[model samples]
Target chain A: MPKLIDFKLILTNIPDLLQYLPITLGIVLLSMVVGLVLALGIALVRLHKIPVLNQIFTVLVSFVRGTPLLVQLYLSYYGVPIALRYWNYYNHTNFNINHVPAFLFVFVAFAINEAAYNSENIRGALLSVDDGEIEAAETLGMTGWQILRRITIPEALVVALPTLGNQFISLIKGTSLAFVAGVIEMTAEGQIIAGRTFRYFEVYLSLAIIYWALTVITEILIRLIEKRINRFRVAQHLVGTPAPTETPIVGAQVLASKEVRS
Target chain B: MITIEHLAKKFDDHQIFSDINLEIQTGEIIGIIGPSGSGKSTLLRCLNLLETPDAGTITIDDQQIVAPHITKAQRLKFRQASTMVFQQFNLFRQKNAWENVAEGLITVKKIPKDEAKARALQELDRVGLAPYANFYPEQLSGGQKQRVAIARSLATDAKLLLLDEPTSALDLELVGEVLQTLKQVVLDHPNFTVILVSHELGFVQEVASRVLFFDDGRIQEAGTPDEVLVHPQHERTKQFLARFATQTVHN
Candidate 1:
């Protein structure tokens, strides 16, 4: 029988798989940027309850969240060419679907999926801001846009950072699924190496090790960012001295010495 | 001067206040005292156009805002002419004390950063909070936070200041510090108009030039502090004072 486990193969497979790491990281970074912009748009729509578009996005976000990401990936990979063909037929345009990169399909699917999840997180963070602070800003003559940019968004960002960091880590891992669309990332490369060598268990274990290392690195970076962002909160616990209890000011003796304003 | 005519507001079916008419002189410290839900806070909010009055004409200095017909520019102008200090302090949590004070000058007035910072520090100094200018709201005590809020309002250079239950949220011991700061503010800027809504009858009587007793969506009595607080004539006013009297004795 062939060796039950090719431990040596596992070690050798890692170097070849590392070459595809850039593709996976690139997808995560680009998708995160695009996903955040789209998520903010969706979050604001839901937050302000904009008329018809709100309802449309509400259903769209719901659909994306409810369906499996794998199914969405397949739909993006297969659905875009048909969509472009119809567009070209109706609009008399010569946009060739064949020229579109496979990575584009993978990117669209991942970005939309990420957006649906992050929009809720963003909306919750936005809502968590105190109404009193907004009112105070308005009273100070801050325009609606000024209040949003200066006060609301900054405050919401602090609340959203940790969850957003988690989302990014998940995105890094989720890039493994890019193989579903013909774009060979780290995991896909691992699969190819395994197929040629027939060291399936060893190759899969190496891929797991690579993913585990990526997750660990991502976690360390997120924690550092969280600490930096929460610098304001660090000194907060130092203060809370016990307040001296005095008589409630319901009706203390109206002091004769204090000149009554007339 | 500020003049209000036929000011009214309601939430769905409940009427907050209606047919309200009042006149306020520049430099006057007008105190409004009322029971909970008597619409005193809403009345203060309408002066700054924070809450739209269902029907009314409000004239603050030369700017006139006729409700239900206010343009965005008119509303902005009205808010710019006055500032408010909330009971909750409402200092921007992300910003330090100095930033909270400077934010209005920098953003609304469009002043240069260095000039705004200087003015903010000056305002903080006036409130005896210059030392704590670098502290965030979470790092300050309740009294300190309210003082920072007062500084922020003062820094805007608004002629009229609206304080809605400013000390209602403070600890009993902390209330004296905020009231003292307010008293000093009144003395320092005698020409700065203030409309204070509070349940602290003693503080109102001490600082208010005139007092209005509100009940059942109306100004039941408006007179000198002695007339309104000590020698109330209206039945509702007397009944309200009587409740406080009972509480004072119980405490």
Candidate 2:
């Protein structure tokens, strides 16, 4: 037999990969938190189009999305430090202690970049909301903020969730870029192993499997979320067939109530 | 009372209307009878400022109805004064019928929750939808949806209610329940004003004090129902009434 391809090697690497899991999860979790906050700001800016800021936001969103994310990471790690160094000297070398942390710079780059794309997705979802829905809310006299909280974002999230889920899968792959900034994530650790053992194939294969498992698990979680939000849609179609329509909203409320760990 | 003077609307290449003038006296039901592209829906939408007309003056209860456009703040306040109900029902699918009706009252009027629910219950009772209050709009029939919509409008305490083809989506049997609800509103309320855009001539005659027959986006015939519907001077109005008569015959 062709030397009994060492399944033992794959099994051994599983524990090694597990060690780096927290780092990967941390980057992704941090990126999503920062991205979501920025996206909400950008989304509202574009959606409501608050004066001159709207045009600036559109350009910003377009510029960020139009470029490759890898290039953005490079610009932050290399470019921002140069700006910081100069600004520090201008402030009498007070900033010589590094104005931007490598992790922080990477986080900001990924977050701002993700927010640009997320704002676009979120804006599309918000726009797809029928005018009647908003009108109904306004007529009910839901204050602008209340409507945003009770109806607008809740409904927009349902549409954005799937697209957001896809983006998160991309984010898993994206955390690999954290390796460039020496973040000690899965891919970074994999690189260390590969360099020491000169075992390029094994190390990279382990990295791919870990990323794949994360994406798969995230995908399953997203489906459960989608099923819950789609309760209203399901109920709407069940015409005259005496089954519950409130299931979808109730399910959605349940999901919404579940505290997502930051 | 609502007064619309020389209201003109143009969209893209085609002009919708050039010179339209009308007045809606308080407690009167005005039915706009028109062909498909005659701007009937646009006219109704413009009244509540749902659609922005190019150049016109609208006065609702002497409020000047002018943002000349529906400025966001002005529009919000205007929405409080009037409400439009589409044939589509336009109920929030996420909310139940009672919540849908109570929505505007609690939000716009800033009524307390207990008071809003009480008022919503009263409004629902008026529309004969008290039983379906807890049920969602999705659970109700088309007639029931329209009734809930009426309850929602009533809960807002709006002076003018615009109905866009209200019964067009309902079954023949379902149509009566919705029309009856409106009739009850007309009989009981003294200050309420109604504008109904419908293809149902029999229903229009039963409700409207005055009928304006429209063709090609202009009022072709305008008078009392007896003058416009029965003794139509315009061939278009005669043709329209004939089509409804034929539709009735075929069914």
C-alpha RMSD over true interface residues, each candidate: 9.3, 6.3
Tell me the deviation in Å of residue B82 in model 2.
0.3
User: What pairs collide in candidate 1?
Assistant: none
Model 1 lDDT tens row, A173-259 = 889889999899999998888788878899889989998999899889988977876656634442443322242211111211121
**lDDT of candidate 2 over B63-85, digit per residue (tens):** 77553565677666666677888
Expressed as tens digits, the lDDT of each residue in B1-251 for candidate 1 is: 99999999998999998899999999999999989999999999998888999998999999898987898888888899999999999999888888999999999999999999889989987987766666678778899999999999999889899999999999998999899999999999999999999999999999999999988899999999999998889989989999988998897
Model 2, stretches more than 4 Å misplaced? Answer: A1-23, A37-68, A85-94, A135-152, A190-213, A235-262, B67-70, B111-122, B130-138, B233-236
How would you class the docking of model 2? Answer: acceptable
TM-score of each: 0.91, 0.81
- The candidate 1 chain A region of ten consecutive residues with least summed lDDT is A250-259
What is residue A190's positional error in candidate 1, in angstroms? Answer: 2.0
